[model samples]
Target chain A: MVKRLSVLDANRCTGCQSCMFACSRRFGVGGLAYSAIHVRSVGGIEHGFVVIVCRACPDPPCAKVCPVDALKVRVGGGVILDAAKCIGCGFCAKSCPYGAIFWNERENKPNICVYCGYCAGYCPHEVIALEELG
Target chain B: MDEYLKNILYIDLSRKRFWVEDRGSLFEEYLGGVGVASKILLEECPKNADPLGPENVIVFAVGPLNGLFPLASKTVACFKSPLTKSYGESHAGGRSAIAIRQAGYGAIVIKGASETPVYVAVHGKNIIFRNASALWGLRNSITVGRVLREIEGGAGVRTIMRIGVAGENLVSYASVNTETYRHFGRLGLGAVFGSKKLKAVIVSGKTMISVSNVKRYRELYDKIYTTSIKSSVMKKYHDLGTASNIIPLNTIHALPTKNLRESSFEYAENISGERLAEKYLGRRVACAHCPIACIHLAALREPYVTEPYFYKTTMISYDHELLYALGSMIGVKDTEGVLKLIDEVEKWGVDAMMTGTVLAWMTEAYERGIVGENEILGLKLEWGSVESYTKAIEYIVKGVNEFYKTASKGLDALTSRYGGEEFSLSYGGNGMPGYHTGPGAHLTYLTGARHSHLDSAGYSLDQETLKGKQLSEKEIAEKLYHEESWRQILSSLVVCFFSRGIYTPETVCETLDILGYSFNEVELKRLGEKILSNKNDFKEREGFNMLNQRFPKRIFETPTPFGLLEEKTLYESVKEFYKILKERARNS
Candidate 1:
């Protein structure tokens, strides 16, 4: 069994961007440039938000689309980015179906969610969660 | 070099030329946002520059804490006001501050008028001026935002600010709608934009800011985050947004209803926060870097008159000020009516507060036979009539006749011609905010630098007085001056005022310390005072005389929750305020 971050109910999201901040803080930096998780309004915020985070697929599309084999599939799920081998080309970000892959434009690297569930901790509305998957 | 405050973008709309200058010294002294912007306005703008002329400058400034901390979400816009014809400052909480900071600029100074309409796009260091001939005269601001969103990339970390027909026509109280829900909603920033022939500004970037002490930063971040989420002080804002104040203010009879003829509205319950949340609350939203989602949007569904099955759902943001101004002040009792009025104001890109106050005055004038039906364009002007008010808004933006043209200038100009000076309710040429709390509210409006309620928040003082606290006029003046001075520090941090409790002087110093800028409590307070003095100096230089303001007789006529505001007490408070300002000037 492995714990995975999940969007329980995205309609409860207030578009607070707390999860995005938490994701950025994991890198000891501020701003949304390097956040693994992303939240955006559906056209306008009145329609609610679309919370995009890696769903921890067994065979991640982001890992499959990597040009230089920089992204390696984890044991449980999700993918780990090997920054050394990466070409800084944004193919993985484009290939991710859920739009979960975040690009660090400053470094030209893909910031992937490693199923750490750090972002879920900051969601006050219980819009996201970390649960065991068997 | 300060990492975030590195570049100041200077855009000359007339020449279509743009350059980035290193403004490290400006940010180092003023620390950004209003502090930096006020200095820029003073330096660039001519002494008596026409607010709607090429001589006027528009400054968009973000602070040091902007991309580095939570709730540091406001971008301050400083300019010569077309409304006040003096020092103008307004703030909007959206992605604007973060986008500007990330876009690698401390401040953006826009000067000179463009020969034709245009929108500037700043994607990191790239500044592109696109012709906005088509965007000009757009009926709805939301459409302008939508069109820009498609044209401009940077989906997540970008802010699109646009104005509508009200701004295009140079309505004196027009606003610049940021993102959709948030706005620089006072003193006619949109009219300033219009004067420049600028329709929109799109800012987006991906820049990482470095923190000096990562460990300590995380600890303080966690502490602030925990406090913001768990603290009861922020709970009310999170739940019902600022509209939570409606019930409490109404209960205390402080809510100005129907042009301040009454202290409270009879149907306050209909438009109450509790009712709105229960019935119409579509969703809550937050500005970038803010954990508290205080922006409340109501879902308004309207069926097409021609098509039986066709319907349109619109999202309208509401708050305490909007509730008071558009809801109670204009005598709108229905929640739907209030939402509709707010939506119209949003679509037109006009300041809701000023629009409501102007309409309230007009309604009163019509009832008194001061302005006849002919002047009202054959439409009956009555309180609680949302349809009539809506039509008036249309006429105002259209500016077709003499009455509409005069009305577009604001209540000051309208009353100056129409013989309703007694109940004009404009302080320093800007229409009044919702609060008719007491002498404190009135005095702040008269003496505060920007003539904004947020300048001093005298309503809080009035509430404290209602709790059996007695204070002299001098004490009230001192408290106001101190609070407003402290707010300079807050606004420099570019933090939202709602989170003032979280960002105390000590906490502010700590946050700054993390960013490698050291300032103790004493140093911070001194800096606050300095900033206040600079703002007041700018205001004074612009011909704002504290003694010269005409007190509206209507405020004294109406009895507030505390009681009728005394003219002598208000005058004493103003005198005290001036004395403090003079003393501070001498000391500095």
Candidate 2:
């Protein structure tokens, strides 16, 4: 069993981008450029926010779409990106159904969630959490 | 130099040319936001420039902490004000700051007037000038935003800033609405946009920002986050939003009602924060980097008149200012009526505070037979009359006649022609804020830069006085000067005023140190003071004289929570404020 970050209840999300900041801060960086998780309004903020994060799929489409075999399926769920092999084509970013894969334009690499669960800790509203999956 | 604060994007609308300049030196000296924008304005904007002409320049700047820190979500917009006719600045909290920072620019300066309508799109390093002839005359800002959103797809990280019919008509008090809910709501930014034939601006970017100290950065981030969530400092703002001030202000007789004829509204309870939360509160949203979700949206559901079983749901954001301006000030008793007027104001892209103040004056003027039915287009203007106010809003946007056209300019222009100068309720050519707290509030309105209540928050001083703290006029003036000077640092950082308690000078210095900018607490204070002085210098250059400001006679007629404000006491306080300003200018 392994724990993964999950969107428990998106309606509780405030679109604060605290989780997004947390994800980037983990890399000793600031701004949303490298964050794996994305939160956007449904239309306007009134309808509430949609928290988009990797669901740790068994057969991740993002991993399969990588031209250079840069992404690999993790043991628990989700995919791990091999930065060395990445070509920066952004195919993996487009292939992710949830739009969870992010592009690091400066480094020319894919920013996929490593299931670190750091972002869940910053969500004040309990909109996201780290949960175990078997 | 910090990677985020590297470049400035300059757009010449008249020549349809755009260029990016290295402004690392400017950011280094001024930090960012108003600090940098003000310097840009002084350098670029001509002296005594017509606010609605090619000479005027619009500068939008975001601070270094914008995309990096929590609650640093404001984008400062600086331009020559059509309303105040002086140094003008407005801040909007939305995705605007983040978008601008990530787009690889510390600031953006728009100059010259376009021959035809256009909308500028800045996506990363690419700047696209699109023909906006079709979108120019759109009735509402929301529609313009939707159209731009459809064409330009940067869903999460993009900010759409557009104007409505009010702006297109060159209304002096028109606002530039951002993200539909937030706005550069004061000092006529939208009129500047209209004058340039610029309809909207879409800013989107994705760029990583690096920090010098990783370990120290994480520690500081955790400390700020813990303080933000655990502390009760932000509880009130998060709970009921700024609308929570309604009950307290009304209770203390600080809430101005019916154009300052009365200090408190009798039906304040019906359109209060408690009532809105209980009955109409739909959702709470936040700006990009802020954890406190202070933006409250009310769910207004209405049925179609012609169709059966068809209903439309509109979400309107409300705050204490809106509640004061459109709700109690106009004598609107019900939350529904307030929401309806707010919705109309948002659609028209007009400043709600100015609109309400003008309408309150008009309602009183009509009652006194100064303005007849001819000016109102046969609509009878009366207090709490939602129908009449709705029609008036339409007329103001349309500019149907001389009265509506003059009113569109602002209270200063309207009252000067229409004979309502006694109760115009304008301070420094800008509509007074919601606070009629006491002398502190009134003095701040008169002398504060931009004539905004948030400049010094004299309402807090009034509250302290109500709690049995008696102070002289000079002491009150000193307190306001101190607060206003310190706020320059916060605005330079582009942080929200709500987080003033969290980000002290020490903490701010620590954060800046981590970001590779070294500054002690003393240096930070000096920087704040210098910024304030520079802004005042700009104002002075543009013909703003503290001694020449006219105190509205109506405010003196009404008694506040403290008592009747005396003319002598106010004059002495203004003189003290002038002394402080002179001392600071000399020191800087």
Candidate 3:
């Protein structure tokens, strides 16, 4: 079974950024600095929100663009960054169509979702969920 | 203190310069948010400075707990009010608090006026002042937000507080709109921004915080998160939002109707929270870091005149205050009319409560012949005429005539020129918020530091009075003073009022203690008292005399759950509260 976080319904998102905090909390203290998932308003908040996260594409463009073999394919469809082999070129971040590649400006490294589903637990509105796809 | 909270960002619009100062000592004693802001307002603003002048200061602050705890999500803005011409403070919940905290500052003190229209962007240590002359007289505040959203770098984390046409024209009660659904909604912050030629302040940052004790923090976090979702108070706030209060307040004959001429509306049920939820409730939203998504937006759909299929749906945020002011107070019976009026004010970026109050006073004055068709500038204002009221809202921004211009100044200014002082329902110079419970609400309106219902729960005290335990004036005064003093702690923590019940005195102490701030419940209470007295010091310094407050005659005419209030009782209580405050200032 492969498990990953997904936005069950964008309409249910209140744009509270709770999931962002939760995602960040996994790396350190509760904060938005380390978040991989994001919920931005569609033009304005009155229109609602757009939840952006890595959808775990099987043929990922982010991996294809990487000059060095820094991003290794996971058991499922997502890729995990090997920080030791990686250079801070930012090509992976620029190549993602969903804009899911989050950058750590302080370290100049890309922070991609680990598919841990930690953020799903903190979404108060049940707008997100961890799904098991077999 | 958290090391990040020690930095205070000082921005000078006149020189287009910025600096950072570490005010660690201030955080040690006064804490952050309102406590620090009140003192800063005193220092930066000149004595009795013009509220809309360049000398007036804007202090936006968050507490030590902000960006660290749940529901610690509000940014406190303190300034000299053009509306009240006294100590002014307003709070808003959005990404503002989080952004400011992550930007590595406890407070941002803005002084001096920009000669040209501009919007300030603060990205952590980065600061940019961009020219915004093109955005200056935009018809809708929503459009301004849309424009900023496209150009701004921080998509999810940033908060853009922009004013609209009403603000650009210096409507005294104009609001600072945030996140479309939220606002710093009272006491003329927008007018101050307009006077400075400041269009918007966009703030965003991404910084990691370190925790002292991981397990304890996690345990406490889970407790607060669970309590916020499970508590009945939070449930009500979540389920229907605050509009649920309409039915209950109307049942108790406490809902202000038609400018308080009637305590309850005959068509109360027609526009109640239940009615809106059933018909037009579109979606729910929340401020940053808050679990209780209490903000309810209504989707109103209207067809084009020529084509039935060509329709547009507009999303408008609604709460009890907006409903009371635009619905019952202005005599709009249907939900559609109320939503339309609410939407109209939202577009203009004026304080919805003040705008609604102004419209109500205008309608009453017109009916009484105090102001004729000539004074109102050719429009016939009726009780439920949404069309005419909509026209008046535009006139407030356009300044079509003398009467609409005066209306923009507020009820206090309106009643002075016209002869309807007795019917005007403002306290000090600020317009009255929803709630007509009795003496407690009236006392709160008159005595609260910012003259807001939220300064203390006088409405809660009305429950005691309703139960027939008649409180003495001293008892009433002491109870209110104590409650208000305690709330100073909450505001200093920068916690949302909805989470106050969850953050009890002990819990607050514990939370602070965990953050390396050692304090017992008693010490915390003492700190709360000191912070409150500091606010009063600013109010009194700016010529806000508690002794000079006048009760509107309309309050006595209307009956509430606590029955018709005795003016003498409220007067003595105000006096006793004055004595209590004086004694504290002396002791301090």
Best by DockQ: 2
Candidate 3 chain B: 10-residue stretch with minimal lDDT: B209-218
Q: Is the docking of candidate 1 incorrect, acceptable, medium or high quality?
A: medium
Model 2 segments beyond 4 Å from truth? none
Tens digit per residue, CA lDDT, model 3, B241-286: 8899899899999999998998899999877889988999998888
Candidate 2 local lDDT, B1-107, one digit each (tens): 57758699999999989999988888888899889999999999999899999999999999988888888999999999999899899999889999999888899
| Residue B528 miss distance in model 2 (angstroms) | 1.5
The CA lDDT at B168 in model 2 is 88
Off by over 4 Å in 1: B307-310
Enumerate residue pairs that collide in model 3.
Answer: none
lDDT of 1 by residue, B98-137 (tens): 8899898899999999989999999998999999999998
TM-score of each: 0.98, 0.99, 0.98
Ranked by DockQ from best down, the candidates are 2, 3, 1
- TM accuracy, model 3: 0.98
List clashing residue pairs in candidate 1.
none
Error (Å) of candidate 1 at residue B424 is 0.7
Ranking by lDDT: 2, 3, 1
Which ten residues in a row are the worst by lDDT in model 1 chain B?
Answer: B1-10
